[model samples]
Target: DFPPLLISLGDLRRGFVFHEVKQVLITDEDIFKRYRERRQRWVGEEEKKIERWTELRGGDYVVHIDHGIGKFSGIKTLKLQGRKCDYFQVNYKGTDRLYIPLDQLDRLHKYMGDSDHPPPIYSLEGGQWRLTKRRVRKAARDLASSLLRLYSIRKVIPGYHFSLDTDWQLEFEASFPYQETPDQLRATHEVKQDMENPSPMDRLVCGDAGYGKTEVAMRAAFKVVMDNKQVAMLVPTTILAEQHHRTFRERIAAYPIRIEMLSRFQGLKEQKDIVTSLKNGGVDIVIGTHRLIQKDIEFKDLGLVIIDEEQRFGVIQKKKLRELRSSVDVLTLSATPIPRSLYMSLMGVRSMSMIVTPPKERLNVETQVAEYNEE
Candidate 1:
């Protein structure tokens, strides 16, 4: 017994059950120091900055600092003051054209406004656009300030720091049926990185249906289970809860992770047994409807909470969700995300990953434009 173990009570149904955690605690100074450092670490500011490499194409709409919204006409070479230079040709209302020098590219930005029913283009002489800009700037500033306060509070609170992925995790990933897209791989990497860190993660994954959002969640759940911490996936409908439960179990069938589901479909006895096991730290992951947020349910250790169809929840349910928000890792999945959700990420309250590119095997559609006819 040279290496002492930090043991706790195990299940009594099988007479004797000892669950060994992945990370071991050793008395050796070097070992203890290394584990201690991983236990309480922080992320740097450089990683928090969102990357901007937007590509603008012709026929795209744009906004100019001095001019109102307009459409891009592409680059045109011109000779000015006996010197040749490249210029971006911009088209505005009423045959008004503005040529901007390549050096002043900072004065133009992509327009993000309605196209089907766009707002009326204002005259350069009016202050209509200026007023709108002032209002938007004020709102963004208020959002940023509130988020800063939240970040300050989360920094001091410690969370369950999971160890890095093992060979088993690598094998599980390799066993995935379909090839992962680049964006999916990127999102998985970010989520895993967050789990390995000390601070709690608040991230959102947005994509259309069948874009592998569930796969990303599954990877994170598996990692947390390997660390001996429980995971909770909350859904708005009982159908979705049952669906996710089945999918999660099938994916981890090769492993020893104990998974359960909570919904009206389950009998009272079954529900009671699941809740008891969850509270006793016998269950690894629980997928359920909003009923999981009720008062009686308890978890010995909840490392991550995944919310699917988060937009469907009511205000009261949201309030209860807020109570569980503190010091706990949260992952939200949504397709056709709401403006409020995107705003939260823009304000730094949450990290967002968008998957827009479709899979390679998807068929390309052919469209031929023709004059409309009432046939």
Candidate 2:
């Protein structure tokens, strides 16, 4: 739960599902009064200010005061008046730009995609986005406050009733074709171990693009589905979702499993049917992009959630993903290779698996780099 705070504290602390916080008898009047006062949460102008450490960092989104929606590219240190200050460089579309001083970060938002379309670009020269920044900031602050309260209550609640059983392990292994790669075997073992543990799993399987990461997820999903439970596989793109749907359908077809794909590209009726099947337990495996996170879709018995290429998801979707991690088994697949130094820093604390070896008996492709010549 503490580690999840690094991702999103609100997600880790959201309201309880089946349990509620138990109230304690007040023993001291002053302490009780102080607690009661703290309970009346409201975002004032001072409260709306984001702390220096809590400001958006690189990889977070920032709504430009002038230009509509631009990402927080990063902060650079600058020497000014014999002192150092940080400037946030925002990449606005079509040649517009905004440079926000570090101290003014309170005026910006850690862009959570509030609307379907990218927030329209306000005229930069007219300073429209800047004018609306305060209102946006206030809204974000209110959301944060609400999130904080919700999480506080959720932290005190107990977990779910349905627990994972181990009957599917045998069937899962039997369904595999082509001997498992050593790395794949290791990852499967890690996943199985996580499933058996009481503490929820938040493991990442980092592998090369074609290094059988999906196969590992398949093994886990098979286990969950075999337990008569539903599984959700969240991809980052529509193309990837379609590809996964085909791959999963082909792989799980050997067993008595029904897999479905959900996305905007599909017909409205088809999506509705698929969603209905998901809610009624007719669909065992669901594969889609972040569209799966929408409120309309509900799983009958979601035991596991497999997220592929999670780094590609937007911040808001990722936030919801974190919310799902508390009690559900979350197996993430990352194609981006982490540097050894950075991995070392996070090694023991975060559970991770790396697939470095190619499959045995597989021939390595011969490659050569030649200078590009325009002919």
Top-lDDT structure, candidate number: 1
Off by over 4 Å in 1: 1-151, 362-375
The local lDDT score (0 to 100) that residue 87 gets in candidate 2 is 79
**Global lDDT of each candidate:** 0.78, 0.70
User: What CA root-mean-square deviation does each model show from the true structure?
Assistant: 24.4, 16.4
Q: 130-229, model 2: which lDDT tens digit per residue?
A: 5676687797787567545544443454433333544555665666777778999899888878776655666788877667788989888887765688
Pairs clashing within candidate 2: 13-151, 65-129, 65-130
Q: What TM-score, over all chains together, does every model reach? A: 0.58, 0.55
Return the lDDT, model 1, position 88. 85
